[model samples]
Target: MDTTPLRVAIIGGGVSGLSLAYYLQKQGGEAARPIEVNIFERKATLGGNAETVWVDLGNRRHPGKPDSPYRRWADLGVNDVNLATYHRLRTILGEIGELERMKPLENTESYFSRDGSIALTDDRELFRGVSDPAHDLSQVDGGKLAVLMAVVHRSAIELVESRRITPRYTVDDFFDACVATPAEMLAAAAEELGVTIDWQDPALPARLERLRHTIYYPRISAMYFADDRGPGGMPLQAPFEYYRIQEGGSPPDRRYFEHGSQHWLEALAAHVTDPSTPGPRVEILRGIEVEASLSPQGVTLTERAPGEDRWEADLLIMATHAEDALPLLTFGDGLSDTHRELQHILGKVRYTRSFSVCHTAAARLPPNRNLWRTYNIEVRNPEDTFFPYRIDYVANRHQNDAENPAYNQAGLPQYFVSLVDDLNRIPRREMLERRPSPLDGPSALAAAAPGEAGYRDRLPPLDSDLEAKAWTLFKHNVLDADCLEAQEEIARYNQTTARRRFEGRQDVCPLLFAGGWTRGAGLQEQCLEQSAQVVELLLGKAERRADPLRLVPTGSQARQRHPQARSFTSVPTGS
Candidate 1:
């Protein structure tokens, strides 16, 4: 029996990497030997994209006194985590004993902004913001909304059922199974749902645009439609899932950690680094850029700093964002066919950039408590071209109070607005020309059209804000061409290599792949699930016992053909 520990190298220190470390440490025993895990992060902080802000609310004991602000934590990057949708994340939280920290978000109403007025909706999924209490929606419009809902429902079902039977089914495969592009599907569904309206009808185009702007973009984040310009939708070829709405829970019914998303990520980091942890000591190398190379010895990771330190590991796990990991992978002189194949597949994965601004400006924000008594406000503007959508009032004060009574006693107000802008699409020269002062308020960064004065006036005054804006790399492939090609190639690779490789050798070429981008919808749950699957693969999980009826056909004709047949030797294994 080999007792030598498996030395594993993990790239990137985000949730995916952290969770992988957590599982590797916990499940290393099943691998026949202890495991040594080393995590390399390029940034000073471990939690990538999951950033939090601790605001200092100045002293209130003596109004005129000069006292430093109290440090209270709030989220600026990833907003909320859904309990119903994110089961894997929930399980992880439970393992870390932070499950109790999860709380339900307060119910809030959404408003549509058009012609400079806000209209509240009774049914957030379908309706627009209208002033009239009894606004009558045209039958055609109502039918369109119903059809959209049906598609969303069907997509969710297909996603769940497919994953249950074929865990290897990539998200690209899910969308490929759909009937048409989201727009075309909407038009077809309308007819099926009895919506009688000409495609060229004057009102229909506007309705579709509104639906896309107010609902689809935010719900799916432009996954279906490639861009903002009407619709010359992407080619629908890959088997990818769309509009992933988890059944039973409304999308708006989301929960946020009182301390922030960073709290959860930090806790995960502590579990690996803390000396008191029960598992083998995991070394975390921060602020180091590692270049990965392959050799007969194993995986070699060379740091990019002066007098660089080199570390060799038995296995390498690229847990970073696919794009980030692609550049770090260096093919040595005797690269195997598997390494080349993986590099080709990874190249097809496309990504787009998204920019968001987080600021503390209570005066610029609308009321947190609406006349309808909702705790938060979601505002949408279809007319503003630069960044049409914005979440005006994300008041953490209300959430803090609801989660803890002691928090409310402080009576400090903290509000933030996040905008999802497609900065990558805009020209570099234009953005640079329009860029405003760093110290300036929201108006400084506003991309409003000319003569759109007073538009910035509605926003609360920006007192202080995060110095570094939230810039993110979003994995995007609308048509499924890239996803499908990647999936098929990976399927072939897995069948020949990933599945055939025995647990006897620790040195392998095709290192494990794990991230939300590799799975369905690129969500938190997908990230957790994919990383877990990688861990399971590394452990060489045992196959479940086969059922007697499963191996032999139970039909009358089949039973007659093989009367004595009970169960076959081969059994299905869990991944």
Candidate 2:
């Protein structure tokens, strides 16, 4: 057996794989043998979809020298984001001492639900500010009110789980299980979390319907319980699984500002890479398409440099999104049965697209407020205002002159806006041309839609063992979080993806999978999270196994992030 440093190949320069490469390099300090890692990206740039893109068809102008704030630039995709990403980012920035210079925005949502003739909003900072244990939640709607009576659900969930009230759930249980309820899962969720209905407000069916419409993001529509497994949208798990998330379970970090998010990615890249360094280098390949093959040993990689085609590694990680990876692959000539089965798994996703109209106000925005305003406007030529979904504006997303010197130079006010919720209606190019995008408006960030996911069973073609092996390697690298029985999750989707690479060292293996699709089904935050997770798996932090823990039938687009992501507990194997 040849014992050499593990030569790793990473395809896709997005967050997941990049983070994986980063951790692998850093973990080298603790490794017995040095680890060698390399990256191959199709784009000419390194950030993949996470980088800031400045696309101008003549509309990219500096905000009226201050009159129209964010009129200058626009992030093509993945901007206004979840705060859970912030927690980790904050620690990173603090360690690097760029916390103050980066100027991150820290904000949280205060939701208030209402119904017919009864509209309420949680607009008061008092709700967030008050530290009373028995405070009133009259303003808020839904069963979340009941859970809050005890403590912010997460704190309470911890108490219940520790005291054995539910005896099975804990604060760290959310992604690993599922839960559901009639009308609205909140009622069942509250009961599972040990919340008591001490106060009196039984609006009966009205409350139930109201809760259904207002509690969570209505678009998600339904909830499936963790222990609901006897059909009718239930899991066969034990009762403990139901209340686990509510009993102090924390949602992923959703507070991190993107500016801060980018800072960390950039810093990590800087820390691990140096153009002049020798050992194993992190070479970012841009604008090069994967003609075929998953590893350099299998196919030829053409680039601007002479030695670019010679790059190869013992280990290759395909961290591309599942959807994007599907088309770039070709199955082996044999094992048609297994290949066909995997096709169904890959076929279940349904993505929707949208355009983010980022605007530097045509006039100054009301000072000091980031808001979502609704308007019914009339545009030029009786066309009826370009977009009337009621603009949800993220003010001061860009730097303000008062806070950062860069904003002072731009002149006007800027707002980073994401106008979501329009998958059903397609916009004509003329519409996009007439109005402003939420990012740079008029030249919006294009439509976006995250679909659902499901699972299937299959095997790799025997004749194309090399392709099978290569795909198997890549599949292991993209297992989302690893909480799922590693073996079962791999079987669920890999047979299909691997089948695409049936021609051995051809494009079959090297085609490389990237993006959020690898995690069953990922949309926005979930996709971004998987991008981080997949990179780790590809880096060898995630180990391959023989079978899944257990298979649970899910929708065509069922997405669940595994537990073995960019996690500190299970340090990846490579570094």
Candidate 3:
């Protein structure tokens, strides 16, 4: 006899949840298992922060203003999904023998480097279609590839040697660190890696923390073009094909999605739902304001749909933010401690404010001169007067394939640049760069916090530090740090950098907690990487599988499954 089709409910239609749904569907195959998947999007549309709101339909991206951006704007920054994530995506496609139909995203292949430049990155083997083949990847000219490779090498060493990075050492002790930063951060990183610090600044601790997470989160085994650190920090390269295959045989386009990295989320959802498949159905609900509650009978989600008094779901999978979900989760589940801890953690989360200005214009990229010149910049003014962050240009992509559909999106000939500078000292400059300049919409500079210090304290337990000891030693240090003043600044600094508080907590959460926030220190790439990871995990057939529509989707089954969700209650599910 067959088992009752496990109903799996995935919340949040954003990239992470969507990726999970896609992978899960692929693993089960069409009709292989009943997966009633429901994706709940708070926004009226999908693509969480990745979605772009087209302000003016007719107006061009720029009215020829000096600082006019591209014809469109994407709030989140992400280009390519890394090799590890891409590997699973490819495997999923291969399993179904539908890999050929997949096409590379247009304008989604490159990124502007820290130095006001553009760089191309892509997996050559995975290239179903390459739009804008000649896309300008500026970092190649500067030999960023070497730096990147060095980083991979260094990460392998740290992961194998120390197993756990210590606070006093860094990898720079072994390899020459390239990415420059405040002296103190660089130094702490060096120390943690068993290296040394080259610079100063109270901000070092936060950067050190970020650097460590970058080197060895989820283990180095999952990295692309990276040899697992050998027993002696000298692991021999296996057959080059093994490494090259992971590279996707494609030339690098540091940034791949010209419109930002949210498109994959949509693509994943599309793959999961096929009318022909006889499984738990997939429902995508959007624009439904949420009120949550928890109880003895799982969880409950209630919403007011169009002309409907109430809607409900059972066994909800909170794919949204941990912070937003904190209050929404009910303590009645006997997970009250977890809820309370999470709530306190969210309170301490620190983040950054983001801003952008869009303009409509028609300009083919890659000036007639050397593509390298496209990276050249004058800073416009460094005195913190009018410009708050670095200024960059969007050049015409070098590799525009006729087969690429997004060429039209690219052909719009637009530019969108952003800046992440000293939030404390750049307001005067930021004010001058404010919006209303023929761009699409208002420029309030959306600000969001990243890390929660209170939540971070819990990491020590998750890190295995509290298992045998029964107490996390780091907690003592955190509470008793010298000059809590400097620690606060470092915390503040991180909020503006990558702006996600989730990086340090990865090894613990089996279900991926993803977004621009958790995508490592590089906010955009990390988030995309996370979305990709869930794709692999879901595809790998992760556990805790229930009806996908158990909560987020509609109908009585959902109501039965999640009677009380998102709200506190006396009926705790746990004893």
Each model's RMSD to truth, in Å? 11.4, 13.6, 17.9
lDDT digits (tens) for residues 77-169 of candidate 1 = 455666766777887788777788777654443444333354343333222223233321223254554354455444434333222323233
The TM-score measured for candidate 1 stands at 0.66
Model 1: residues >4 Å from true position, as ranges? 57-71, 107-111, 117-214, 222-253, 274-280, 361-393, 397-414, 420-481, 484-496, 503-510, 542-575
Strongest candidate by TM-score: 1
lDDT string for model 2 (14-114, tens) is 66666556556545544444567767666434444443322222322554553332433334333333333344444545654545544333222222212
Span of ten consecutive residues with least summed lDDT in model 3? 470-479
Among all candidates shown, the one with the greatest lDDT: 1
Measured with C-alpha atoms, the lDDT of residue 93 in candidate 2 is: 50
How do all the candidates rank in terms of lDDT, highest first? 1, 2, 3
- Regarding TM-score, does 1 or 3 come out ahead? 1
